[model samples]
Target chain A: MSNGAVILQNISKSYKTVKALTEINVSIAKGELFGFIGPDGAGKTTLFRILTTLLNPDSGTATVEGFDTVKNYKSIRNIAGYMPGRFSLYQDLTVEENLSFFASIYNTTIEENYHLIADIYKHIEPFKHRKAGKLSGGMKQKLALSCALIHKPEVLFLDEPTTGVDAVSRMEFWEMLKKLRSQGITILVSTPYMDEAALCDRVALMQNGHVMTIDTPNAIINAFPVKIYAVRSNRMFHLLNDLQSIPETEAVYRFGDVVHYLSHSKTFDPLSITRHLDSLSHTEITVNQSVPTIEDSFMLYMRKSDKFNISQHDN
Target chain B: MTTERPKVIEVKHLVKKFGNFVANDNLTFDVKQGEIFGFLGANGAGKTTAIKILCGLQSPTSGEIKVAGFDVYRQTNLIKRNIGYMSQKFSLYEDLSVSQNFEFYGGIYGLSRKQIKERTSYFLEKLELTNEANKILKEIPLGWKQKLAFSVAILHHPKIVFLDEPTGGVDPVTRRQFWEMIYEAANEGITIFVTTHYMDEAEYCERVSIMVDGRIEALDTPAMLKQQYGASSMNEVFLRLARAQSAEQ
Candidate 1:
């Protein structure tokens, strides 16, 4: 059990009629960067709250760094730094004051754990005098992260930390996380962004309170069953409808300028679709076999689960 | 796709300032009718300030701006009436039921009772949420709530809709679905002026403008921006521009 920094076994939680989590089991090894990838209502926040000792599961056992979340709630609180989805820092207080406050609560000084948060803190250090509320989205993210790490906890739990941040800042934040992982801090982060799944060492795709799959991002992507093709035409609006009408096209979704056509048959030829679009008078048609991304795999898994739910309902 | 779509939004030499800080510096752009214009920038790069000015929420320091052919300075009321807006924090009453939220927003836009009832049913069926019409807004999934908020924002059939990071925290599937709705609205000849931090989402826009340090660094279609910057993706293009600005700073 000590092999993993965090462990959950048969964890189930519910609120009245809604099942927040169902038979959930996951493990995060020491110093590993783990990601919970799902939508907003996918029970990510509930699981995070339980693991941080703010909420207890109705059934099953959970542990953080060898301490039971329920039995050793106090110990878990002391050793785990949790940055909730919402900005939890004092709005009226300045950045430096907030850092000092969090450090103080852990019975430590900023200087005592400065090394742990120095990478992230340095970005927001210039605005140390500004109120946390006055900072921009990206700056606030950094300040909140700095406060979370101010206590030098063994594990860091961040809930959608990079939400609403600019692309550049999001890339920088992930870099900072990788650096933190190098320093041997077990990080469990949750985000709704499928692109972010690739940044994690391993990610768990959760939906409707169930874990669909957990593996390295590469493995998850490679396991996509269907062949995907990226199709482009001058008239993108009409191209979508045209591709959907093709019998071979099983799933089609717009990805930026191109429509990703996922065919059910692995041997499906993409040229036939191009010819079909061309026959529809769609000009500048281009079709290429595309590699499946994390989002593609996630959507496939979601569709599979939806079928399962529908069959169960019919029964 | 056509260049003769008639400019829906025109801005020239637009500038906004707070004390000594210039938030929007001499920005010039024209958004064509039925176009999805992506307004992209880093934090504090003047995107929000410029959007507020366009929305007539704040008077610009200096500019010649026309939204839907109404002068921003003199016809602010007219501009407000002809436009819709949704912010990062979804503009919906969480305690209100889905149908009730629709009715309330429709009322604010001066919709008649009959019109509200008709449109409420239309949107609910379109979103496949007729079964959950009476459910409180907070009880629905984030994706559904976002689509509802967007539907309500456009209930008045505004000529233009300004979305401020509409897909900020939603999943990719939902984000894709939301874009489909936007495309449907755009097809109906409604101009979409969206500001987002996601560069990939920027690629969805017909044209995108990158703002840096209170000024536009680049503006073009995503393909052109990538080619101009010698980058593979929009994310790299944004990073190149943003990092260059940071290096200079």
Candidate 2:
């Protein structure tokens, strides 16, 4: 009701006995790049489906571009483009055919909407005649995005668009999205990769059908409550197990070659941890205090939410 | 440490072609034992074709290749016996119980009944999944299933293991745990040959090779590759190479 590009008020959904969403409230501004980040089975897809008018919420209301998802669904559908988490375009159809088909559905020609998807379409232009099924992973993602944008929708919903894409392709995909946003399209993307959260203007971190936190990636990361240290040793396999044995170590998770040791004590000394690893016969152990990234903040939030939910259930 | 490690795999002038399209063009590389070797490439960069050839899944068009100290051409059966393979997609039967899947794979790998039992218990206990061993694979979470898949892959004590994007779609914490498992395997003298799209993971490997347009465009430690390309990260290094290839095309 506040005239945001998308608004959800106490939206709740359930699939049989499983609650998929619980009192979810989020507001995204016009032309903003919004991200929904969580792991698989975090109800990200369910929320996206409700917003795109593909599915209905069991309670409360949701709107996209000022149109009600349930009542004015047809109107919402007309102005929204959705690329599902999984590939959904016509596999047997050529890339050009798929774009034309989507364009025709909106009562327009591909040439009329070419400008909207020109940047993305040009990548797949060479394979325009190739069957969609034969396209490479990165090429198929481009094709799907092109088809979705062929109708020139005012809002775009991309669910896990870069889930299995390569690092370079992922960067290119995000660049394309940024261009679309600059052209005044409101975008809501969902992804499981926490690193991608940094690319969004705002992100909602969700788990177990609940929204734990929503803010700019920097704000969320800045609000991390604990100290995280990157600790590495010549013996990485044994380093993890030995670090986990520390009485003060809260969490020991590996990040590439180094293990991130989370501690609840702010007065923690790096030398003490290194000394302990050194005693364990580890060589060249290096422990450095590190700033928290999105992943670290997410883990902290997820753990806190779980504890809160458990205590509430007990009461 | 590297000087003491022996070479477990060697490929010389590897060439694989489908009709006129060259999939892998004269690729040559050596993977050392007990090292995590990263095989990186963009999609459709012929990574899959080269991996297929290495696993003896397909006959190379023309190449001198050896895997696990056995010739890939005439001694494929011997080569296959000394390696483990896992892909991004779950390979375990959904309906089968965890123990059942382990047993099935054990039979295929020619493990003795006694050996299978010991290996199954050791792995399940190591992963803290002993209680869930009787549950069907469909009931387990994806992170647990992936860990289980990796455990089953190396149950036969293969000298080399090939992981094809084994951590795709998993959450970051789970991915971290999966890599820890990988490090444990590598510590046991298992040569890990992995293909991944995640750039951060390339940094984890002791050595990495980036394939571009069916050729090994770069090969070195992640630090060396980044330095050579004048880049900040493996992602940047890959972009430089991939963009160059696209410009040529």
Fnat, one value per model: 0.73, 0.68
Candidate 2 wrongly placed segments (more than 4 Å): A16-19, A232-238, A241-247, A274-287, A305-315, B230-232
Residue lDDT tens for model 1, A87-189: 9999999999999999999999999988888878888899899999999888888898998898889999999888777777788889999999999999999
TM-score of the second chain in each model? Answer: 0.98, 0.98
Angstrom error at residue B16, model 2: 0.7
lDDT of 2 by residue, B118-151 (tens): 9999998988789888999877777678888999
Give the alpha carbon lDDT tens digit for every residue of A153-239 in model 2: 989999999997877778889999999999999999998878899999999987768888999999998888777888978887577
Candidates' lDDT values, in order? Answer: 0.88, 0.87
> For model 2, which pairs clash?
none
> Which pairs of residues clash in candidate 1, taking residues 3 or more apart in a chain or in different chains?
none
Off by over 4 Å in 1: A307-315, B1-3
